[model samples]
Target: MPEASPWDGISVPAHTDYTVRQVPGPTAVPCFWGRDRSGACLFILDLDGDHTDQYRKNTTTINGIDVDLRGEAGRQRLVLTLEEQIDRDLFGGLCSTLIAALGNASDAPTSLAVALAHIRRWKTFLSGRAAHHLTPEQVRGLFAELVFLEEMLDRGGTAPAAVQAWLGPEMSHQDFIFGNTAVEIKSLSGTERSTVRISSEDQLESLNDNLFLRVYRLSDLPDAAGARSLNDQVVRIQARLAAPEQIESFDRKLVLHRYAPLPEYDAPLLVVSAVRTFRVAGDNFPRLARSGLPEGVARVAYDIRIEALAPFECDNDLVFGGGNG
Candidate 1:
């Protein structure tokens, strides 16, 4: 049996045109969580009036998600049916976000306005596919940056500034730079979790800025609790950005990172348990500096063995001096 929905107990007057509900979970959005009659995790929203024409004009495929419009006159419903081939975590997050923002509200005009705005944004993302194809390398790089942002939030950093300043693909070397500190994030997967890939010698050559290396050992565990996808992390970070300008900046950064508001990132689930940080300064840190490398090697990239670099390991908090990271 499906779990009770969060909107199950919400009551409405008999004369009301429609009401909203959701499948029970700790989700931040109002949406059904269980399988549909056809046995798929589904999301359904009921609008008060007919939206047939609107849905017909706006219907478009996004990352294999099928948007369907149903219901009779005087009451219309929008159903976002999920496909089995896409990443389930991202799909679920999309449903949760849309449902929570558009449904379970008494004000019809306000709900419709918000829904239209979101739809326009989605359309724009779909149209920009040619310009922003999310590559595997970009996904991994962005994932590292996201994990760092999550860590910063956990450490009580100012969210608006921290999230806005996350320079993932924007900067060539450092993933994030705040004040005089530059953080290089490397995410590694596979059974060994043994190597960190350095993109270029210049990445670790920033001598003037305080440097730190954040290593995330991530793996895909189908049943792991608290695992979050790139999209999931994005949502969590957006909640912290209270200022409009900060939120806009974060959105722009997402585009630069090739992270469209789509449900097919194929993004690895973050292993919150396997996060580690190390101070990359001093002689103990193992790296190839630009000045030390051979004159012929310009854009040198190499993998450093994790086991060999254990001597310089430090607590996660130590890199940020125990305050906001």
Candidate 2:
């Protein structure tokens, strides 16, 4: 940022919650944490070192942009850094998790860059830090999963599949036959706040009945092997519906049941968050720069959070929670 005018320094709010002093003057400054309900800093100007001017106290816009100094130049020029805007856009876990970790896209709140920086740290976050992480290829396999959901959501989000068992001795409802497989993925380097799931079983249940695909994403480890190691119960069930020669059919409409044990973790931070699921679709993980979320993964939608920790928790005493982050 350019140097501020003389009057600017006297009248502008640096926006920094904390400031570092240097030989010349103040050096670095902190940014907004987004959870300060007490409101932004208030300015009380003093004329001869006494009572002078005071501005109303309230939170101001946190763009990390220019200061709002009433156009004073020359000796009135000043320079200072205010706290940049924090990334508290994560919408999961009751707006509590988002209250922590204040900072800008450069750092804190676990930016995409930060998540990608440490394969190990990323894994830690995915494993115990956050929820599941969807790989690129697996997302493709779940196209039908998301597509079916989208169609359902478009059409009231739920409908009776009507594919019940044989009603009478020789009768049934709608004879629908489909295969379902449950898949689980694990990720160590997925974007921090980006929810990674092509289609979750809960959302699918909201769409239809007699079918379930439970996907559990594991994020305990940094590598794929680490994820697999967490829950190594590899139960691979393929589609088995092409049976011929008087095969015993199950339901009138096959209530296909599939599951994917995705990388397990603390929470399921989806790509889409509050108030804007349909607004953004098929974007990408917040941090990791994958070729794609598995081709044809067909992302129904996702919410991306710029911050890593929860909202307004950055400036808090426990930002790093006992230090050493």
What C-alpha lDDT values do all the predictions have?
Answer: 0.62, 0.23
Residues 115-178 of candidate 2 have per-residue lDDT tens digits of: 1111222223333432434444334223223323333334442223211221211221111212
| lDDT score for residue 77 of model 1 | 58
What range of 10 consecutive residues in model 1 has the weakest lDDT sum?
Answer: 104-113
Model 2 TM-score, 2 decimals: 0.17
- Candidate 2 Cα deviation (angstroms), residue 324: 63
Residue 321 Cα positional deviation in candidate 1, in Å, after optimal superposition: 1.1
Off by over 4 Å in 2: 1-133, 158-325
If scored against the real structure, what TM-score would every candidate get?
A: 0.61, 0.17
Which number leads on TM-score?
A: 1
- Stretches of candidate 1 exceeding 4 Å from the true structure: 1-138, 190-193, 266-268, 323-325
